[model samples]
Target: MSYLTLFLTAFAAATLLPAYSEILLGTLASQDYPLFWLWFWATAGNTLGSVVNGIIGRQVDRFKDRRWFPVSETQLHKARNRFNRYGQWSLLLGWLPIGGDALTLVGGIMRVPWLNFVILVAIGKGLRYAFVIWVVLKAGAMAT
Candidate 1:
């Protein structure tokens, strides 16, 4: 049940919706939950959430002209320019806050291959969770 909660939180965090999984991961780590599963579930959930953004991005172009469209033309244009400048490699930064989600979306808009998208996102998010886990464990060690 705890792992499920963490997975869901991590998944939601990766989406455009506001959520944070790092804090939960840290809390669980300090409690001494299984480290590998915690990292695995968090990374998997987060990476899958970014995949959702990519999927939306692929279809979002058609909706840009609608009144309910969330992004302005100028904003989309600027995002496009930045994505193009950085190319697909920019997906590596999809783990970043704020701009990270947008980067994944732009990756879809630019039609980055799906395999590359998943692999890159997984790597970045996995590394982030690993760092978080390491920090929590290290801190706990010092406290003891």
Candidate 2:
């Protein structure tokens, strides 16, 4: 697949959606696609996806206190408490599996500064893609 396809996959994977861009990245890398472009596209797409999650979190914050809101008041309170305890540094985990999406969302809900959010998310996602690419290249070298 092309880099654009990889980009889209990475974008969707970064969101709450059930997609796995890493697998696609590995497949393409194994096919000898340029590592730099693959890494760049995947990181860009994933970071943008996290930004979207943050924006959604911001919107959800507006309704979190409503009686009919999906999240219970207690849940919101607990989440806020955790955010307070962990502080903004937790956003660096936005590259993790499973919970990364939630972390990005919570970053938004807690009103993390947009600039900080983007920088942290970018760093996290970039490192993740870089690691994946590194592994792919290392394995390829071993195979050859």
Candidate 3:
């Protein structure tokens, strides 16, 4: 159940939603939960959530002309420019808090390959969770 909660939190954090999973991860780490499962579930859930955003980006154009479209042409244009400037390499920063979701969405808009997207996103998010776990463990050790 804890793992499931962590997974859900990680997944929600990866999306445009305002969710934060780091605190839970830190708490779980301090409680001595298995590190591998925590990292695996978090990475997997977050990556899948980013993929969902990518899928939405892929289909956004169909509704782009509608008045209800969320993104403006100017915003999309700027996003495209930044994406092109950084290239798919920017996908590696998908674990970042700000602009990260946009990076995944823009990757889809630019048609980044699925394999590449998954690999980069997973690597980035995995590293982030690993670092968080490491920090918690180190802090816990220092306190003892």
lDDT of 1: 0.93
lDDT scores in order:
0.93, 0.90, 0.91
Prediction RMSDs, each to the true structure: 0.9, 1.5, 0.8
Tens-place lDDT per residue, model 3, 60-128, is 788888999989989989999999998888999999999899999999898899999999999999999
Q: How high is each candidate's TM-score?
A: 0.96, 0.93, 0.97
Cα deviation in Å at residue 61, candidate 2?
Answer: 2.7
Best by lDDT: 1
Itemize residue pairs with steric clashes in candidate 1: none
- For model 1, residues 1-144, the per-residue Cα lDDT tens digits are 999999999999999788999999999988868899999999999999999999999997899989999999999999999999989899988999869999999999988999999999999999999999999989988999
Instruction: Give the count of colliding residue pairs in each prediction.
Output: 0, 0, 0
Over 4 Å off in model 3, which ranges?
A: none
lDDT value, residue 20 of candidate 1: 94
Residue pairs with clashing backbones, model 3: none
lDDT (Cα, tens digit) per residue for candidate 2, span 53-123: 99998998678778788888788788878888988899989999978998998899899999999999999
Candidate 2 matches the true fold with a TM-score of: 0.93
Candidate 2 lDDT at 56 equals: 93
